[model samples]
Target: MPAWSSEMGAAMQVQIDKIFKEAAMQENIDDDAVFQEGDGVLAHLKFSFTLSDPGLKDCPLIGCSDGFSELTGYTMEEIIGRNCRFLVDPVPQEHVENSARMVAREFCIAVKDGEMYTVPDAHREPWMPIVHRDDGIFCIQTNARKDACLFKNLFHLKKIELDEKVYIVGLQTEMPIELWDEDQPEEKRQDACRAACRACHKNMGAAEQVMAKHFWFSSPMRRQEDGNDEDDGFV
Candidate 1:
């Protein structure tokens, strides 16, 4: 039996519904679903429209599940009612602006621009996307190295300064390890040449791994001068 009364369930569902419904209607969405369990409920929303401008005022519904706020150094409130472009530097405003125009036409573009990029594992090849929105915007997304449209597999190591600290980010190849069954003896299968599987592993140590691969965020090195970096006290 469920712990909460039907009345409570209805009210919670209402809260969830209102939020998503409001989001979809005001922003770039048409329909959404709300689920209820116990005292809390969850909402999975999808916007039907392409957002040329992803601002907080347009999308107020959010969650702190992954501590993205701390990672990007911005509170949820600040992120809300503002464009995600805040993640980009003011100098790159032109690039973001042009990308927005592309989305309006619904054309997928993967240009090797040195600005917007992502590195999901914070290593390997960054995934950059030519964004085409239903509402008509063309944006690129990447999850690999830096603004360079290159990967660790092909490009040499690069140096980046963050919060006054100078660090080198590069590609290093390491063997992949897989767990094997100890209870059963190893057998030579038709497609198996070796018992252990070796593949590529993307690893980041300490400071290099602090930033995420794909999404954009403000870095201390974006503005701080080299000699004056020590005074900033950023990690």
Candidate 2:
């Protein structure tokens, strides 16, 4: 996974806004028309914000579609204002440290009547294995009690294979800085910090490689000749 470039992120946001605006227009036509039962179009969940707010500590779920309730066990009342990330268990600190340290958020969408709709919540339980489709693509259903209605809906809308594996990979939100204790010797603490910084840089580079290979995006990780950039590399 690789971090999205500023231009790419802005482009995506524009597209997403168009989708939501169309959905809103449709809603105005008929309140009961959006998520009819058995429509086979997975309902979309709409939040107040189109993009994630980096400054906020947590992203709250302000509103969701009726289809969201149908897929998840909880209704809008239970889910609204809660962090959507809660659907899946937290990633362990050790796992984050050992892996590429990138978080890949998944979103499923469908186009109906020339309007694009997206599912609000799509996450698999931490315990379940990633499911593979006949086409060799991997998928993880939302940890909801109901079946994968959203996925099924998306498949129905577009007969093409879905690439759930495509991820907006970026640095892990929280780093394991606490792994070093203050009581440790100054030299030992400094060494540990250096090691952690190196690991972060390595993970970031790996993520960039994946993005470049798969999406044809240029690498965002630039090597510094001075080597002082290591101090600012703790992601």
Candidate 3:
């Protein structure tokens, strides 16, 4: 190869830099964890709280993230003050799809309705650690976006007490499609559906499933370990 002038080498380097910069920006658009925090939490992955409003009989959106708008194709103004249930698809919970699930759904509904549930005493299972789960809710539900596109939401509700105020924060993370794979082992699939929220809490890495693509308009999700990354209602 012939030796190149310093100017020629510099020109090539500039072009290479430009290409890399473009690629990085594209990846930022594709990945969800656009921002990271000093505390190691993904800012866009987790957002605001909701109160269990008795009079309204609904959990309204008290706050949210910009990532949610981008993913769902909705503007912040549209969702802010509305009930989060507006996005619930109803299909997954209603159409359990089999006899086993039909029975399970009844039990799940019961548990939801303040029945057949008791707090397990600490040390009952050495493998399981005791945690205050009374106020937190863990559920897997299908949700729809602005245009009626569907995706599974690993919905987690957290309880926070600040003096006299209690905040029930709704933390949503999109789940991977791998959970629905037909080739997945039967035992694994069954356990996913049958066990308590802990099954997915462990397997899917709770609060860390933010590595979701725009599932509706995109290819299969390549989630948190794969890469990584929310919102509210209006006036």
Candidate 4:
């Protein structure tokens, strides 16, 4: 399995989380999603059920977890309405050719075969296999549970990477200003409101009011030296 630095993992986790949230909201709520969590990471799958009882096309994508996007490097916007083969590499080695075929046909095949399944930009690895049911609509239940000993467990590490990626999304997104907790006592609370107001007063009057929004209520960097001195005893 490939190892990523803690920083990369942290950064990726944040984006993955948002991806999962969007998946959840889209799939089960209003057919806006493409996949959902049936179980733990491996058990998660993309399900399609037709609305008009004709074919897979009638089935609207509802939701998919962040793992889906992480493995494919495509957001939900690009994935929905696309064939599953979008993730597979068009040209593959002999070993992976069969696996790709099995996935393309939507058949239940084992991943232990020498063939590799391309996961878009992520990797050209074996397709993780499970019992695939294509009788009515496309559905796959991954069989390689953590307990199962497969030759190359690609999904395991991939799932972990996706999970870590989702966790990193927290750093990238922000909440509404009013949503912040207001219960902190004065001594413990930093005066962001005061800082913001002061900024608005100062910058709003400047000739370049166009840049005012960028500087409003921005946080000041805390010096490392100040932190060190605060931790040290009086000399």
Candidate 5:
């Protein structure tokens, strides 16, 4: 019997809660946001759905949350048509392959639109699997605030259908150090966020990989990468 991520019912609920909470903390939302998922996270969930064009190379952001706006200091009109990764300043820690680490960093810092969004080349280790079912790409990525200050974000990317059109959604929250005094040193915040990223990632493995509520396509899902549009399926 093959398993799928859709079977993760209770876990889904927890993911939703965690996602909302993560977003709430970053922009300094009220405590009420802790339970209700903040103000703009849900409304701002749908991101760049431009995956329709095999010709278009980059994934653009269609919308974002108010908390996101607060955290990055970007207005809706300004960010509506840019690659989400433009905000990224990746801090590489999980290195399966040198290529994977480089790709992650390049996608975040170097590559232009559509360039970094592709899956790893067939010859390399597929370290960055886009876990479709569970919570998408749950990682601790550093993004530059509008003020040019670097901040850590609990980033998430998921693909969904809307009006028969497919779009990739992005959600981000500034995770805070739990139980640690705000007066604590900056290093502690890094430790807390790193731990949070690890725990979130750990939950997505195991049985959940079988369920793979992640994605399904009739003709294998292929994406355009660096050179000729070659791919080994899902990103």
Candidate 6:
């Protein structure tokens, strides 16, 4: 092979140094420790906000990431210090089960906005939908099986603004089941769940690679409008 010139060699060395520096910086970042292994799994982003008391009027966005901006079409400047409820749309009462509504009311009792909600331990049930306390809207759904749990929790709520109209984003994550054993320990079950989550993220990355070539090449004008395209539509 031909040797690189001194100038080109120096530039290449600088680029390598920059890559290492960035990798080190990312290692130091504390957010989303669960997905920080950096084995090619997509990093999951989480947002938290503070809700007001009694009237619950001033629900300000406290934290977010660039991933959220890509998902929601709103920059941190536009979203931070603003009520997250702006992204929440009211759910129809007819669709919500009475039991879920009751659970939501109980979950919201004296709950502050910035506080994180713990997903309940419902290992016996196949599916359980968790509703947001303030809006009574379905925010998350959980499943008893490990793979099912990953599929349900992976892609979360995001609101997209298109043509000056706000629309709730939809994305589903699907993973094929390899085995179903009912006798696994709780810790073992959780490990399986994390593996499943990683698998789904990897699968999404693979699909994007294919779409970037075949689908996008076929229609150069039609780009993925938002982050929801990352999901496989299983949910």
* Per-candidate RMSD, Å: 22.1, 22.6, 17.8, 23.3, 14.4, 17.9
TM-scores of all candidate predictions against the true structure = 0.21, 0.24, 0.43, 0.24, 0.41, 0.27
Alpha-carbon deviation at 90 in model 5, angstroms: 11
Clash statistics: count for each candidate: 25, 0, 14, 29, 12, 1
- Rate residue 58 of model 4 by lDDT: 27
Best by lDDT: 5
lDDT of the structure predicted as candidate 5: 0.40
Model 4: lowest-lDDT 10 consecutive positions? 166-175
What is candidate 4's lDDT per residue for 1-235, written digit by digit as tens?
Answer: 1222333333333334433444454544222121224522212422111001012342222233334444444565554544443433332343244543454342211112222333332222322222122111111112111223211112211100121121100011111123134764442212322221222222211211111111111212121112333311111
Off by over 4 Å in 1: 1-57, 89-91, 94-97, 100-235
Point out the worst 10-residue segment of candidate 2 by lDDT. Answer: 152-161
Give one digit per residue, the lDDT tens place, for model 3 in 88-191. Answer: 63445563223322232333343335444223342122222244544344555566777776765554454432222333444445544455678866555334
CA lDDT, every model vs. true structure: 0.25, 0.30, 0.38, 0.26, 0.40, 0.33
Single out the weakest 10-residue window by summed lDDT for candidate 3: 208-217
Q: At residue 149, what lDDT does model 3 achieve? A: 67
True-vs-predicted CA distance for residue 227, candidate 3, Å: 31
Name the regions of candidate 4 deviating beyond 4 angstroms: 1-54, 58-62, 91-95, 103-235
The deviation in Å at residue 90 for candidate 2 is 9.6
lDDT of 1 at 136: 16
For residue 36, give model 4's deviation from the true position in Å: 25
Task: Residues 63-181, candidate 5: write the lDDT tens digits.
Answer: 44344556677765566567665665342333123443344444433222333244345523222334433234444455676776665456544343333344444444565424235
Superposed Cα deviation of residue 23, candidate 2 (Å): 13
